[model samples]
Target: MNTNQKTIICFCEDITKEEILKAIEQGYTTANEIKRHLRAGMGECQGRGCMPQIMKLISQKTGKPREEILPPTDRAPIKPVPLGVMGKISKGNQKGV
Candidate 1:
């Protein structure tokens, strides 16, 4: 494959290989760091589709084993919720919107 080709890693986030490389060049070498810098793994898939590619890129750029580059931490509220649900909760707690 052409090294300069724009490979899409995070389809949901529209992240590309060049973007990932730029993140690495900017010292975002770990997957989590790249995630913070580029929002590569914060899309609808939530790293499921892009993490492997991100890890591979980090490993290749940093000369670290893939396993050594830790995955981004998965936090609570793993799935998104409707705004209406949040609005209802807020209304119940306070007098005003």
Candidate 2:
């Protein structure tokens, strides 16, 4: 998927703007909990792309400051690297060479 067209909100995994609002209505106050319950940011990218948009939506809906919303967990593999790169690194390295 092209980066520009990609959305910070994931709609395909049954995550909708309304659903996020509903989760807020249900008192789920953290993005982590929302990720667990709604699977909105649980896809392959692991929510790196969608969390910001979700936060914006939350801030708008609840009248809460954006800073009050917890930031998303920043895991490794920042960019989606090809497995071929991993394979090359592994094969080219030798123990105690």
TM accuracy, model 1: 0.76
Error of 2 at 56 (Å): 1.2
lDDT of each residue in 1-97, candidate 1, tens digit only: 7676688999988999899988898899888889988889898878888998899989999899888988899964577767898778677967554
Per-candidate total of colliding backbone pairs: 0, 1
For residues 1-97, what per-residue lDDT tens digits would candidate 2 score against the true structure?
6544433367447576667878988987678778877888777777766788888877887888999998667665666668998677668866633
Worst 10 residues of 1 by lDDT: 88-97
TM-score of each: 0.76, 0.64
Task: State how far residue 94 of model 1 sits from its true place (Å).
Answer: 20
Using TM-score as the measure, which candidate wins? 1
Candidate 2 clashing pairs? 8-50
lDDT of 1: 0.86
Q: lDDT per model, in order? A: 0.86, 0.75
Residue 35 of model 1: what lDDT?
90
